[model samples]
Target: MSGQLEKIRGLKYIGVVELASQAARILAEIGTTQDRGTVSEMPDERTLRYYLAEGLLSPATEKQGTASVFGYLHLLQLLVVKKLQSEHLPIRKIKELVDGRTERELERLLGLDAKAGAKNEALSYLEKLLTSPSASSPRSQQFNSPAADMMRPVAPAHAARQSAPQQQGQATWARVEIEPGLELHVRGDYAPPTETKGVRRLTRLLLNALEGYRGNMRK
Candidate 1:
């Protein structure tokens, strides 16, 4: 479990401030900052301490003399937690989701790699969020069997509408189609999750909310 974090390759040990800064730089570089004309929520040193205390994050990978040092994976972990929080997920749920997740999994979840900037992979990931619902064929047996009766894309819109506590007063939207011409609107400064699990989680929330709609239309 602790083996993957033992070595960070290039970085020997980074103080808490440096760790947060590096994470911020990565977020900014990935274009999460440019989208809203400001940087997204970044965990500061104090927030990092709180996360570590709550076990939401892994321990620092290494140490330098008397100072504890963090690895690259630590940086990735911070970003992952931040992304999950942006979705309004509770810390307990976020902790559950990220616990024991490997370095590769973390980077993939964030849709980043060493080649991202050159390849514009971040932009590509954004595109995926828009098209993921449409890419999956709606289950033919929807509402037929319990297992198949889940949210199926009927008319996922290009954008959704909802207000947010994250970015107050700024209208945000995440559109998920529940049925044709009927869509779920999540308003806030919303950025669609770039990972599959996050997408599924949101889909389930939308699906549950539409239960009344389904029940009413029962034939």
Candidate 2:
């Protein structure tokens, strides 16, 4: 009907006005700089143009250079190293923090263990792997191959696998799973059981419980 159409049009106009007001308020707070003058006032086309030119309003981009390119885990490791450095912990202490079972476990311990034993274990493994003869060169040692650089130990694949099941199970539980027969009857891909009638019933039950609890508390 014409009346219904007019009501819908009025709603749409109200929504557009609300959105424009919010955007204008946001722009007014964060004043822009332009060629004419610094915008301590409300934004217009000029302020938007200046922001685009300065790359200040550009879309998010990926982090580049050594840290990110090496590995995300390595970047996290570097952050941990920096924190340890600030605390004035020695190299051996820093290594222990990295190799510890947990951060909490390391924080409890005060004494430094034997550094020679740790270094020797690491050196022995590296020596065997590096000195092994390759098909390309009989005399040359493969100490610093590209493959070695890429061979940083990944987190246990099982850890990643365990997280995926828990996340998916949570999503599944939260969703309303309808039977195919009822789904067809509702004429939608998925139909929620919490319809108007169900909601009214739930609201009544909640109100009744609240009133009963209040009466009991007063007594």
Candidate 3:
């Protein structure tokens, strides 16, 4: 139902030039550049490939590749970050600008906000690509299922903890159900169970897992 979901479902083959143009336009609209430049300056094929390897532009996988005009998007984000830095916008403020706007709306702002939008879009697109049927194989699907299945024991763990006496000077543990069949056993040595900190730690762990998964997928 989201615009990103729609794009992922409906996207077909788009030319490299067309992709570049679209990315450029979005960046320009978001105010990534003060001069309102076009995508003409985007790197050529070889340079773009290098950029992708460097993680400047996220590399497209086979199934959801779509000819990869990500270089333009990356460049736009960099330009916007630079512009925002020059304007003395704090990181939080810049993040707020990006978080508050849709991709199209951010494009209209044309600065740090636009850069934020670009980064968000790139990440979204990457997720779609990674999750698409074409990007994953049967084995990967199986691996993912086990990871999901790990959550089943969490409810019992929570129930057991409820009946147990709280121990002093012992690490506290929480069982979190991330999704159906996926649960995390979060252990912390600090006093006062701050759910926020647990969630942050879990999120970081998941991100690290995803990064490794992506790397393995690439290989």
Error of 1 at 181 (Å): 39
Ranking by TM-score: 1, 3, 2
For 28-138, candidate 2 gives per-residue lDDT tens digits of 333322334322333343543343243222211233442112222222233334345445666555654554233222222211123354465467556754553222243
Error of 2 at 196 (Å): 80
TM-score of model 3 (CA atoms): 0.30
Candidate 1 residue lDDT tens string, 38-122: 3246668898888888877787757787667887677778888887777678888787667767877676666554445435555
Which of candidates 2 and 3 reaches a greater TM-score? 3
TM-score of each: 0.45, 0.16, 0.30
In model 2, what is the error at residue 150, expressed in angstroms?
A: 42
Candidate 1 residues lying further than 4 Å off, grouped into runs, are: 1-9, 33-40, 113-219
What is the RMSD, in Å, between candidate 2 and the native fold over all Cα? 28.9
Q: Stretches of candidate 2 above 4 Å error?
A: 1-69, 100-219
Q: Could you say which candidate leads in lDDT? A: 1
Deviation from native of the Cα of residue 118 in model 3, angstroms: 14
Which 10-residue window in model 1 sums to the lowest lDDT? 153-162
Tell me the TM-score of model 2.
0.16
lDDT of 3: 0.45
What C-alpha RMSD separates each model from the true structure? Answer: 16.2, 28.9, 13.7
Query: lDDT of each prediction vs. the true structure?
Result: 0.60, 0.34, 0.45
